[model samples]
Structures are given as C-alpha cells and as structure tokens.
Target: MGVFKLPWSLLKDINKVMRNFWWGQVEEERKIHWVSWKTMGKLKTAGGMGFRESHSFNLAMLAKQGWKLLHHPQALASLVLKAKYFPHSEFFQAKLGSKPSFIWRSIMDARELVKRGTRWRVGNGEAIKIWEDKWVPKLPYAKIMSPVRVLSPEAFVSILIDPGTKQWKTSMVEDLFLPEEATLIKQIPISFNNSPDKLIWSGCMAPVLKETSKMFLPKPTIKNLIKELEDSGGKELVEEFAVVARRDAAVDRIQCKIGIGLIIRDWNGRVVATSRKFRPLFPDPLLAEAMGAIEASCFGLQLGIKRIILEGDSKIVISAINNREENWSAMGMLIEDVKIKLNSYEEWSASHVRREGNQAAHKLARDALLHSISSVDMGIISHCIHDCN
Candidate 1:
C-alpha cells in the first residue's frame, strides 16, 4: 500500500535508456535512490514490464487478509481457527487476554478469522491441516483471481490471499482495515478519477474489496442513560452529580439537615459569635467563623488588642460555602475568599471547637431568642409578607 505512494514517473521503464532516464530523474531531478533489477520486462511465463513486485504485493495482500480475517471470517482462516482453539466456542482468546468481557469476546471471534494460524493435533500427534483439499473445490478461489481463468463475478468476491502459502483468505480484505485507516489517516484531499489503474482497484485480483460495513454506532442517548440510572444501583451518585451541576446557575441555599450540639459562652456579653437552628450549613458556618476571624483580626488593626481566638462549633456553617452538592464543594472557594478578607486583620484563625468548648457562640444564640416577642422592639427580626392580587 505504501508503495503506491511512489511517484508514477519513477515507475521502472522497459528499455535500458528509459530505466536510466527514470533513475536519473530521481537522482538529479527528484534526488532519490531509484534502485531496480538490472534486467527489465520479462516474458509472460517469467512474469515481468510485466514487472510485478512479487514480494511486496504478497506482503500487502497478506496484511489485508490478516486485517479481514480479524474482523469477518468465513474463509479458510475461520476453518483454521475453529479446528484449533475455539472448537466448541464462538471466540478464542490470546494468552494475555484470557479473561475478557463478552462484548470483547465477540470482537475477538472476528479477529480470529483473520489470523487463523495452525496448531498441532492433540490425540493423533500430527499438525491438523487448517487448509485442506476438501476446503477448496479445484481451487475455487484461484480460478476467480487467476489471470488464466475466464472472468467470473463469483471470482470478484473471493481471492487466494496467499497463493504460495495455499492460505486462501476470503475476499473483501481491504474493506476491513482500510476503513479503520481512513478514520486515522487525516491529510489534504486529492481528486480521484476512479481509474482501474488506481492501486485501490488493483485489489480486484485479490479477495477483499474496500469495506462497506456500516459501523454499529451506540444508540443509547442521554434519555436512555437516564433510564439506566433509574435502574442502576449507582443512581445516587448520578443524582449527586446532577445536584453539583446546578451550582453553575442556581442561587439558593440548598436544603440541608444537620446535627447540633450547642453551647453558650459568658452570660454577660460574648454575643458576636452566635448560632441558631439554621446554623450547620457549611460555608455559612465557615463564613461566620471566617467573619469572626476577620473581626478578631480587626481588633488588632483597629484597637491593637493582641489576645484573640475566633471559634465555632458549627463546622458546616463556618465553612461559609454554598454548593448544590451536599459535600464541601463550596468550602474551598469560600475559604479562599474568607482568607483574603482575614488578611486585612493582623492575626486570627477560625478554630473548630467542640460544642462544650464553643459556649460563647452557642450562648449568644440561646440568649438572642430569650427576649419576649411583645416586650422588646419586636419588629427587629419581623417582616410583613405582602400578598399581591
């Protein structure tokens, strides 16, 4: 196949002068090695101008056969594979991949047909013939591919892949591997006239034609995935991912329930650090703690007070981050923001204290609601709900 890429002008000519001209063209003009047989254009019996690259053509054809046998197998390769490895099974496995998925096993069966190598017979102690006379009815494949034979449509579909090996791989070998190559072979496009002289068509004498198999694309759309989620055990994770996906847009404190272990500090007035029923929401807790840190730092910046400790029992709330996800997704972002705010202060850190240790914030929260609704300025926390008709 790579040989086809060689320039047409470089093709060896019949006459000595013509061959020299071709070689000179490459050496002086194109500047290439242009090596060749000293003698050119042999008779029909000898098979030469008439110059067939017997070895390269053989290899490329074999490679094509190997490619085809790997994917689709109805040829001698299939028979060989069946006789040796997968006598009763639909697929064979290589030593490295003995345990593979069922889907992979099915694909393996296709590859097996292309690389149907032989094996020794177990009982009788003789190598069983993968290709036998019974398999070929008077070289049915050879007749179609044979230049000597009369033209037959049946011949067009089959070819003797390895005439020397007597390994007649099934037709349509190029179709299997070329399409895979096409997917990877990206380049500038060139116009083609679909001439028989084209190397693509030269495979007519061989078994395989360019493949036309429609690749089976996966059809399970997102809707199908949703259906799968409904039944799959990992549905919770999928649901959680969905929740996290909401963070890009939604702007609300997502609902969360939390464990509470409240404590209060000095009865006099350690009221700045406070906690309440809606307290455990992380980022909120973290933010509150961060606010405490900022304020504690401010004391040094403003009044130059040295001793300071900002503490919070509400680990979740003090995190001061909001995320659609129930986890600490918002914590990192919030922490960074809080850290920047705290930098204004001289020194302070938000400490996570046990409920027993965090009495100051806890007590402030308890005392905050201790006032009677009717007595003190009751409108402080109250707002009217307007009903618009």
Candidate 2:
C-alpha cells in the first residue's frame, strides 16, 4: 500500500479505508477467540488448554506447504529451485535471528512442522529433503568429515543428450547423480575413442602433489568432489549435456498418437478397453495412426514400466517405428510422438510389436473410435518385437 505515490486525497482515503475495514476486522477477531495455551510451559495436552497456538499452527501449515513443494522435484517451480541449491547437505533450514528473503522465509516457514516433534528420516529411503536424515547418514546428506575414498569405479561417464536442447553432456557415474564440474571436461582435449581407460582409471599414476605459492593440487576424489558440486544450475547443465552425448549413439526414436477406438480388447472374452460410443474426431487415416503412437507412449511413462510395445495395423504408422519408409507431411510430429522420453530412462525400450500380440494396446485404439472423446487418450505397450533383430 505504501509503495505507490498517489494524490494526497486518494492516499488518505485508501489508508482510511484499510484501517477502518481490514484493521478493524483483525482486531475484532483477535478478541473473539484464541487457540493457544495461556503462555504456560505445560503441554496443551494432559488437561492443559485444548486450544492450538495460532502462531505455531500457522507455522506448521506453512511447513506442510513447503514439504509439498519440495516433494515434487519434477515441477517447474521445483526444477528452478533444485537448479539453484543442490548437491546439498543433510537438510536445508531457515535459521533464527538471521532472516532469509520474504519468499525464502515463506517457503521455509511453510515446512516448519517437520522441524518439531517429528525427526528427519525415520524411514529407510534416502530422500533429498530439507532436513538432515539420521537414518541413512552416509548416503547423500551425511557429513561425517571423513577421509575420501581412493578407489576405482566401474562406469565413469555415459554420453547423454537432451532432445529439448539438442546439446550433449557426459555423466561421471551412471545410475547415480553427479555434480556439474565433475562431469565437465576441464582438462585439455582428451579423446573418448580407442576404449579410453576403463572410466575409473583416470590414467593410472601414483598420487602426486605439486603445490606452488598460490595453488594447491587436489587429490581428486571423484565421489566426494561430485557431491560438493551441488549447485542445481550446474547439476542440470551437466546432466543435460550427458543426455545429449549419450543420445548421439542411440537408435532413432519415433512418435505418434494412438487412439483406443481403433482396436478392441477382451477381458474374459468380452470387450474391455473400448469406449462406449463412436468418436467422429478420428476421421482421417493419418490422425488415427498418429494418435495410436501417442496413446502407447503415455501408458509406458505412467505405468513406470521399462519398455513399451506399440502395435498398429496401419502400415504407415507401424513402418515409421520399424524404419520401413519416409514419413509424410501429414505425419507432422507423428514420428516424434513415442520418442524423446526414452532418453531419460536407461532401462526403457520401445519397438513396433506385431498387430496380433499388441491386443491390449490395440484395444485402447478401438475404444477411441467409439466415443466422441476430445481426450488425447494414450497408453503404453512395450515394443516386444525389438528383439526381432
């Protein structure tokens, strides 16, 4: 309210209205009811005041909201945050006496409930949380201040490619998250060809130390050093790079949408997956085929399954996945439909299954033709025919 500069009359009236309407309501409410103990150190339990302290109660609510935000690591806001602060310690906290920014403090306070009564990491899983987890201390968050391990690793770097950016990066340790600088090629140009030393053998040499007046040589601990490189921006930048680099050698991926209305499935020998009515939207041959591929991929991602098999009777759609012919312009993004997402999942695979074996997926397509659904209904079926190689 005070941030703006308005005419004297306007400002005066605004302030007057705020004070009379808003302030009056707040003052009146404060007097009406109180949800707190009477400033006593005793528990509100054990026959003490049954009222809840509004201050702590509000703080607890804020804390819960913060937990939700942190829980969704894949969300846009979360992605922005992890990019900011990562390779983090046991947990993050908002300290007393030293106040963080308004937004920061709000997020911290929103998750304050976890700070009280409940302890961090009661379970076995090592969650990237805002509190130091005591259960699995040595995992990611534990700060033991111990000596670094000097050992060789099995998988050093995996070339990764990000379809979104069309860029490449390298991963230091596969199956585990690594920091950015650890993944960057800070050294002079080194070729990856000729089966360059088995990842961990960063050139077999006894540990050497050469320290000058201003420089201290690091006895590089790939593991610990990677942990310290947690700044989220650096982590994502390097991860994206790795994704792109790995993608270069990957098999071509194709995308298209598949509607369930085109195929029928039977549970106990009766139609199970088809929609109730005929859908007029899927009038064209190309659209019907494109939607099939889309439906196949969505199911794969949702089921948390490894691979998907998409089988289509449409030769054009099936050929696109099997690499039989060129894609027509009518197939705009049809080729890009079931692909790209496979880049992130190391275990995931997809193939063009035979139309007979892909009965379940085909059922979804058949159902799509029945109902006038505007939904982009998608499902996944592993391309079991990839092994046909």
Candidate 3:
C-alpha cells in the first residue's frame, strides 16, 4: 500500500479478509461481527482499539511518500523521480502530462494531502509570495485572511518586516490586512537573526518548537499541551494553589517514588507558598502518583488551605479521579483511595498537567532515588519554596 496505490476492490477484499480473521471465520464461513469495523478502527482514547481505516491509511501512506520526495530531494529515489517526472520543475510545481506511469500518477494524487498539511514558517521570508503562499499560522492553510488584488507577483513576506528594527512593519501590515488579521500577524514570532524561511508540516509541528519539517515526529507531551494553552491565553484563569505531582518508577530496581509540588498564588501573581516533597517508595509509579495525590491532600489540609486544585502528570490517575466512577483495574482501588482523600477538602478538583508545568515535583521525585527516608517535612525543603511579595 505504501509502495503503490491499491485498487478499491483490492482494498475492500483485504478489509473483508481482516474482518473474517478478527471474527475467527474462514473464507468459506460467515459469522456475526460483534463490533463494526468502524468502531474497531477508532483510537483507544475514543474507547476502541486504534486500527487503521484501510482507505485513509493508504492515502496517508502515499502522502508520506510524496512528502519524502518533496523534502528529500537529494535522496537517490527522490533524485530518480525528479529526473523522470519533474526534470524541468520543482516537486511542488510539477505538472501532469498526457501519459505518466501508474506509480507517478499515484504519487501525484497523494501530493494534494501533503500540500494541505504543510505551511511556510516565515524567517527572512525572501522566497514566499505574500498572497500565493501559506504562512499565516492561525488561518487555514496559513493563507491570507482576505484576498489582495494589488499584490505583485514577486511580493515577499519580507515586505511585512522592517529592515531597520527587524520587527513587523505595523503600518504595512495594517495597510495589507484586515483588523483581525493584522492583530494575528503581530502575535507571530519574528527573528532578527535572518534565518531562512522553513516549510512546516502541520501534523508534526509543536507549539514549543514552532515547526518541524521531519517525516517522523514525537508525540505531543503534556508539556506541549501546557505550552499551547499558555500561548492561547487560556492558563490565566488558574490563579489558586495548584498541587502538582509527578511519579517515577524504576522497573529494574522495583522501586517507585512520587514527588509533590505546590503553587499558591493570588490573582496579583504573588506566590503564597511553594513547596516540594518526596514520598517513600511504592510498588509502581501509578501507586506512587495516587499516593502523591493523597499526600498532597493531607499537606493542604494541614496548611488549612480550604480551596485546592490537585494536579498530576499522570493522565490515567487524574482521569480516573475525574471520571467520578469506580475503576476496577489494578490502580482502581488506589485511585478510589485518592478520591476519598480529595473529598475531604472543602473545595477541591483534580486535573492533569504536562510534566513541564510539574517540573518542580518531577525534580523532587528524581531526588528521592538517592534517599532512604520514607517522608520529609515541607520545612526540610524550605529552600525550594518561593514566596512572592
């Protein structure tokens, strides 16, 4: 399927074969499918095993091949394809002719997906056309918010930046864009360092890194989620003390530790008390995280903090607590225990944060590996506390 486009009939037959195998049936036998293939193909987070839908998967795979050909022009296969189909033109601008090979035609068909999923990251911005290219991050395809009738064929993104200060030329942007569009352009980061503009794949781009043109990208972490929320002006409302917990498991050593960190702030951004703690070793990281939440609850109670927001980097534990239902899994009992502790608080809520937001707790958890102590007072780690004036 990655090498060449499969016929619709062939894909259908393949899906049928897979469906039969899933239901424990032979080619000659028919059986009831307990679950629909559509349900089975849904992601695990959506309550189904993540199975590939054949048609979309095929298109995605082919689009990946097209992406490779465009990005890896120096590669042997890319070089060969370039010579054969696009000798006179670049990959992005390549045109279909009267007769092309089946493979080349299939590659062209997939190129549309690659085009839709990529945008240009402005840098020096010498090559990108103002109206023609996709560079606006918030808009679909990074396209201009409104059509520009007077844009010159050679007009570049560099025109929008001031040569003297390396900042956005606000007057020029105001002249070129609608009020809302101009506001969005101001939020985009510009570098005075004169780096070349880079192509960014939408699928692989992260808010932290801005853009990545790579074929394989890392999954978005909790850190990325937090950064995105912060960038979007969404984290401003969280003004109270939020307890963050991070857990670590040393599988080889059969040891686990949980670290707890607290941030108490007023609406004015004054920190009330910040502290870190390390709990004794537990059987597993999930247990450690659950225990950490219970420990944080106790810590808050002792402090006489009436309102608390419990945060942990462990999605499983946090989700279990938030679901407000009994979980019967291995950590279900522990999660239930944590829930009971949380309930003791006058006003409390449990949420998940990315490890980035919970770094203080993570550091404390890692530090626990060197100690044999079961628990320590917040007083001992007084140096870790920061009291804002």
Candidate 4:
C-alpha cells in the first residue's frame, strides 16, 4: 500500500471479509454486526477496539513517505523523482506530468493528508505568508480566520514582527487581526536570532528527549501496606505498592506565566520525589494543570515508579484523562500525551481533589514561579510538606 494506491473496490472487499469474520459469519449464514467498522477502527482510548481500516491506514503510510520526500529533498529517491517528474519545480509545486508512474501518483494522492497535518513554526517569519500559510498556532488550520482586509492578502508574517526587538508588533497585530486572535498571536514565542520558519507536525509531537530507561519494582504485600498505613497516620493508604502523585498549577494570568508542581509519594505517604517547573504563555489554568500531569508522568518514569495514583485539583482535566475521550480542542495533544504515559504503567488511575487537599503541590507551584529548582530527594519536599512519614 505504501508503494501503490490500492483500488477502492479491493479495499471494500477486504473490509467485508474482515467484518464477516468478526461477526461470526459461516459459509452461508450471517450474524448481526452489532457495531460499525468505523467505530471499531477508532483508538482504544476513544472507547474502540483499536482496529485499523485498510484504506485510510494505507494513505497514512503513503503520506509518511511523502513527508520524508518534502523534508529530505536530497535523498536518492527524492532526487530521482524530482529530476524526472518535477524538473522545473519543487515537490509541493510539482504537476502530474504526462503518463505519471503508479508510485508518483500514489504519493501525490497522499499529499492532502500531509498538508492537513502540517503547521509552520514562526521564526523571522519572512518566509511564511501571513494569509496563505498556517503560522498562527492557536487558530484552526493555524491560519487567520479573518478575511484579508486589514493587510494585503500577500503580506508575509514578518510584517507583523518587530525587527528592532524581535518581538510581536502589538499595535500592528491588534489593528490587523481580531482582538482574540491578536492576543493569541502575541502569546506565540518568537526567536530572537532571526531563524527561518520551519514546518512541523501538529499531532503526536512528543517531547524531544523521551526517557527510554525502564525500572520495575516489586509489588508490596498486604503486610507492607498495613505497616505503611501505620507509619503514615493511616491516611491515604493503598492496597499495594503505589505512588501517589499530587499535581497543581500556579497561574499568573497578567503575565501569561505558569508554574507546575508535582509531589510523588510512596504507598506509606513518604515523599519519594517532587518537581517544579516554570513555563510561559499558557492561555489558561486547565492547560497548565494538564501540562503539570505530563511532567509528573515523566518524573515518575525517571524515578522508576510503575503503579501510580494521580491526583489533581482540576476536575475537568482529571475527568478528561480518566474518561479517555477524544479531545479535539487546543489541549487535545497534551491530554493524549498524559494518557499515553499512564497506559504504559502496570496500573494507573487519576482522581480529582479539592484545592485544600492539594495545598502542598499548590505551594510548590507558587515557589516554582519565584525560584527555578527541582528536587529528587526530600530537600524541598520536607520544607514544603510536613506530613511525610
């Protein structure tokens, strides 16, 4: 399927056979499907069985190859294709020349999928067309929704950038875009070095440095659980070896700055680890809380904790993670990352708590804004929290 596009009729027949097998159809007898193939093909976290539909899967695989061609233009395959099919133009501008080969046609057909998933990371912004390219990170399709009226439709993103300070031209942005759009555009971080614009995938972009080390600890027995409860004043005890992670976010709405605080405890309520990080330009508190959870998950991986009980102050974010629903909003990608991390553990659960129950994490979050520091030992945790056994 990656080499050539399969016919729709063939794909349809393939789906029919798979559906029949799943529904227990005999030689001549058929049973009710009960569920649609489309529903069954959705991700498991989205309440489906995680099946892949053949045609769309084929297109995705082909799109990946097309993506490689665009990013790796100097590769042997790309050079050969460009020399023959688009000698006078780049891949994006290439035409379906006379008698195109099956491979060329297959790749070209998948370009739309690649385009839909691509977004531009603004730098000097000189290379990006303000109205034509997807440079506005917060907007749908990463493009301005307002029609081309304030500025010329041919304007480049550089026109809105202040070269003197390498920051956004605030007054110009307000005059050019809607009030909300202007705010969002300013929140986007600008490169001070005048770097060129770069294309990026908007979906499934995980942290650049992913932790690959694995550490699995032995599960504690009932006797150990009882002993831990006794040592910790019988509060928040679990049935087995578990790590409780309390997370909170401190928000400075006026400055668009946020601090994420995380406290990880053993089943006995001993502070095993704590993390505090400072981030900039988070639009809302919910997003900050979600980001805090992502950091907490990473911290847990660093500490080699496999079983976790995640607690947070935001009910909305906790519910979203626990329910595992399909999120299509701006924070969708963050939520997906948290879910993926938790699913890797042997057992993990998320629950909501009131601010009062998460005060220690709240304090850490506030401190993160004032001081940028991290603690793997009890140094910071001991000072911030006194209930550790």
Candidate 5:
C-alpha cells in the first residue's frame, strides 16, 4: 500500500467485509449494526472507537510516497519518479503528462493532503517567494494578500529582512503591506540562524513520513454520518440543543489560592446557570483554566445539556484542547483529564475568547476569592450576569 495506491473499489469492498466482521455477521447472515462504520472510524476523543477506514488509510499510505517525493529528493524512489514524470519541473509544478503510470498517478493524487499539511519554513529565505509560497503559519496554502502588481514576482522573503542586523526590515514591510498584513508578517519569525528554507508539516515538528499514521486519518466525518442517520429516520440523533458558556480562572500567587468560574447562557445572552469554586492551590494559571473548563463541562452534564460551546480566556489551554496536542507541561496530566471528561458530551467545542468577552466569568472567579467561598451557585452570581450586559 505504501508503494502503490489501492483501487478505490477494492478498498471499499474490503471495508464492507471488515464492517460485517466487526459486528459478527457472516456472508449469509444479516445482522443489525449498533453503529455505522463511518462513526466507528472517528477519533476516540470524538466519541468514536478509532477504527481505521480502508480508503482513507490507503490515501494516507500513498501520501507518504508524495511526501518523500517532495522532501526527500535524494531517495531512490523519488529519483526514479522524478526521472520518469517530472524531470523538467518540481513535484508541485509537474504536469500530468500523456498516459501516466498507475503508481505515478496514485502519488500525484495524494499531493493535496501533503500540501495541506506542509508549509515553507523560511531561513535565509532565498528559496521562498513572498507572493507565491506559503510561509505564514496562521494562513496555510495562502500567499500574502496584496495586489500582485505592487510586488515583483521574483521578490524573495530575504528582501523583507535586514541582512546586517538579522531583523525584519520593518519600514520596508510597512510600505509593502497593509497595516493588518504587516502585523501578520511580523508574527512570522525570520531567522539567519537556521538552515535554508525547508518544508515542515504544520502539526508536527518533523516532515510527515509513512510512519505518521495520524496524519492520514480523515478529519471527523461525523457530519455526513449524521445526515445519513437523519435521512434514515434517526432525526433525533442530528438534533443538538446548543448553549454558549464562558469560563475563567483567577490565581492569587502570594496566597496559593485558585478560583474558577463559569456562566452558561442562551443565544439571547440570558444566563441559565453560573457557578464558582475555590481551590486550595494551583501551580499555574493554565491548570486553573483547565479546571474551570472541567467544572463547566461537568456542570453542563449535570444539567443534561447535550451541546456546549465552552469559551475560555486562556488561549494556550483552548488551543491545546482544540488541536488535541499532547500537553507536556506541569498541567499536561490535568489537561488530559479535562479532555477525557469532555468526551462524555454528544457535541462540544472549546474556544478562546478575549479577556473583555469573558468579564462575567472573570469577575465571578475573583468574587470566589473575596468571599472566601468554596462554591457559589447561579443565585449568588446574579450580579455577574448584569455586569455582562
């Protein structure tokens, strides 16, 4: 599978058989399935059993070949592929020639996924074009947004940095970019310290390879499955009662104290529930933030809320939860525990909000400390709701 792409029909048939075996059904015997194969293939953290889907797995395997062709130019397979299909052009720029080989076609088919995962890491920046290549971390597969006529096609990323000082040429950047684009450009780190421009997978530290199975799994396709269920008389499964909730934490370092607060609200901004709790100590703000999320999620569960959009002021914690990255800090274990707790919900999302947007929760957290209270309910936090308005 790594060397050649599997036929889609063959893969589909195999998955069908696997699904039957999974549910203990024989060729002659028909049986009811508790869950669809599509749902079962979702990530465990997303309420799925983490089963591998055949078509996606095959595409992922083929993508490894594409990755090698892009990043490992010296490999024998890459050399041969280039010699046969793209001798006059780079892998990305190569055109599909007349009657391409099956293997070459398979490899080319996987390029989209590879392109989505990888981005240019600028070093001396000679190899990266400012208007053509993707170097911005925030915007993947996107060039700087500006009129093409304003910038020369040949302009390299190096032109935006001061060669002598190894710093951004701020004046040049400001002149070339709109105010917002200038700010985004400054956020992209340029260094004379590392190797020349290279491609890197966005999620991981290294370039993607065949062994990185996680990269190939299709993003949760639960939406499609939900639609299918709805069409098949499972309409209740597609319905969600969503509510928005904001959470915040306050830590008094000198007193070794921690306070967590959350407010759940309807779309009209009317508060449905509010809670605050005091903890003995939290080593850092991140842990306190994670605890606040856990508390909010648990509180929602107790209220029989099935769908929640959990908001927090901690960008670091919210990003970790949304990305599903393994946290390695002192709060790593606690964050993992919070992630596990979140899996119980039928639908949930963790997002970051600016401090000003989470004022109600922030004030409630501080109130927990002022009142020396271990816990406070919705009735006690009425003033917090008024403050939000």
Candidate 6:
C-alpha cells in the first residue's frame, strides 16, 4: 500500500470478504448486515466503530511516502525520483511528465489529500505565500479570509512580520486582514529563535482525528451542569462539611490590578470566611482567575478546612485547573500553582459557574476594586455583597 495504489476491484473484494465474515455469512448463508461499511468506517466518536477502508487507507499510506519525500529530499529514493521525475521543482509542485513510474503515479494521486490535510507553521515566513498558503490554524480553512486588495497576489507572509523583533507586525496585520483574522494571527505564538517555516499536519488529519471527534457532539452548558450537581444530593454532601469556595477576580483598569474575592460557605450556606486580595494585572483574564483560585485554596487551608468545592465564573481557568495535561501557555506557572494548591486538600473539586450564579463572589470582587476595604468578617461579608450589588 505504501509503494503502490491498490486496484479498486481488489479493495472491493477485500471489503466484501470482511463484511461477509462480520455478518456470519460464510458458506453462502446470508445474515443481517445491520450497518453499511461506509458508516462503519467512520471514527468511533462520530457514532461509528472506527474501521479502516482499504482503498482510502492505502492512499493515506502512499501520501505518507510523499510526505517523507518532502522532509527527506536527500534520501536515495527521493534523489532518484527527483532527478527523474521533477528535476526543476519540488514534489508538491511536480507534474506528470510524458511517462511516470507506478510509484510516482500512486504518490501523486494522493497529493491533493496530503495538501488538504496539512498547513504551514509560520516562522520567518519567507517561503509561505500570504494569500495562497494555509498558515492560520485558527481560521476555518487555515487561510486568510479577508478579500485581497492592497497587497499583491504574490505577497509573502514575511511582509506581515517584524524583522528585528521576530514578532507579528500588529498594525500591518490588522490593516491587511479582518479584525477577527488579525486577532487570531496575533494569537499564533511567534518563535523568538526565528525558525524556518515548515509544513505541519492540520487538525482535520488522522493525527488529531480521535481528539477532534468529540468536538462534533453537543455539550451541556456550565449553568445546567452546576445546577444538576447541586440538585443531585450536593446539599447532603455539602452538609457533610464539604465547604463551597466561591472565587472571583475584578479587573481595575485605573489601578492596573486584579482584585480577588473569596467567599467560603459552610453546610448551611452561611459564610465561614471571606478574603480580598490584590495582584498586579496579567495579560489575560484567565491568569487573574487562576490566581483567584489559588487564593481560594489558601483561604480554605488557613482556616484548616479539609474538603472543598471550589467554584469560579471563568470556565477556562476552572477547566485548566482540572485538566491533567501539562499547561505550556503564558499562565502555565499560575495554573500549575493552582493545581498544586487544590491537590493539597484531602478532598477538592473545581466547578465552573455563570457570572450570575457566582453573584456573591462577583460582588465582593467589585467591592474590593471600588473601595479600599481589604478583608471583612464573615458576618459583614454578606451585607457587603448585598450593598455592592
């Protein structure tokens, strides 16, 4: 399959034998074939058991050989193929000459599939075409959506990058692309080392097929999930000394600080303790939310509370805190601290809530930003929240 494309007749015969065996149709005794082979070939997460189609799988394997040719141009097979088939151009740009080898034809047949499944990761961006290449991963097609106007058709992606800083030229990008596209482009992290641009597999390819399969399914909203948790004997659990720690962060633009508010409630929903803290502003709100979570955990520890149900309005921060995967973002250290802090407790959990659901902590955070009041007693905290609201 890697060296040559399988004939359609052979692929069909192979699939027929497999289907007959699966449906217990041996010796001409037919059985019910409940599902179509095409449907069965879909990924498991997409409502089908993951089964490989021989013909498509064969092409994918051939495409892998073509990919190898792209990355290993100096290999023996690559050298021979390049010199004979495409002496003047690369594999991707190579066309079918008067006569071509079977292996070359097989690989070329899968070129479009390979191209559709891959994108370019920008670095110096000199080799990447701004309009033609798939470089922006955040976009639907991984290509620029804005209509071409000021820039010529042949413009390279390097024109949008700053040479000295090795960072995106923000103003130039904003001017050239749509507002949303520009925002996404800026979010794509630039390498400080200024590495060369390289071709990469896009998420639509088989490499990420498993992870992305769940993306097609519908998800319950945070509010519904939180309400369901509370109704499903969470009251009984809370009464068993499971403290609810509600935390929020309010950004103070004038002072350039994040005002963190924490409210710990006991079994009866009465406040056990209250805390207010201030930290320097972070580039993203997720960082500020993560800091607030750390503070919540510390507040519980200081009071010697063992079990906790930490709640926050920031879904991203809550998700990050609960995720087992290693975070490598700008606020990765802060998220790591939050995870460590939460784990210190004998029993702990993080839950996301809508802003309206976390009114008390939100009020406290706003009060911390509006007034100079730092901390308040548990009794006074309720009144403060009401007054602020």
The estimated TM-scores of all candidates read: 0.20, 0.24, 0.53, 0.59, 0.52, 0.55
Off by over 4 Å in 6: 204-389
Worst 10 residues of 3 by lDDT: 209-218
Ranking of models by lDDT: 4, 6, 5, 3, 2, 1
In order of TM-score, best first, we have 4, 6, 3, 5, 2, 1
Stretches off by above 4 angstroms in model 3 are 25-29, 207-389
Write model 5 residue lDDT over 238-324, tens digit each, in one string.
444367888888988765577887888864566778887886543357657876877887788888887677899887777666654
* Model 6 clashing residue pairs (backbone): none
Could you tell me how far off, in angstroms, the CA of residue 226 lies in candidate 3 after the best superposition?
34
Clash pairs, model 4 backbone: none
> After superposing candidate 4, which stretches have Cα over 4 Å from the reference?
25-28, 149-151, 208-389
Best by lDDT: 4
Looking at model 5, residue 167 earns an lDDT score of: 61
Give model 3's clash tally: 1
C-alpha positional error of residue 361 in candidate 6 after TM-score superposition, expressed in Å: 22
The TM-score between candidate 4 and the true structure equals 0.59
Give me the candidate number with maximum TM-score.
4
Candidate 6 global CA lDDT score: 0.75
lDDT of each: 0.31, 0.33, 0.62, 0.76, 0.71, 0.75
Error of 6 at 151 (Å): 2.6
lDDT per residue for candidate 3 within 1-389, as digits (tens), equals 78678899988888887788888756677678999999999999997878787887888999988888866789998998889888998878998666888888888888889889877766677868888888775676678856675667668998888878767888888887887677667645454346556666754321211133222111223345446667777655444423332332221134334444444444354444444555433235554566566666666667777656677787766666766433434344445556666666655666677877665566545444445333444323333322212
Relative to the true structure, candidate 6 reaches a TM of 0.55
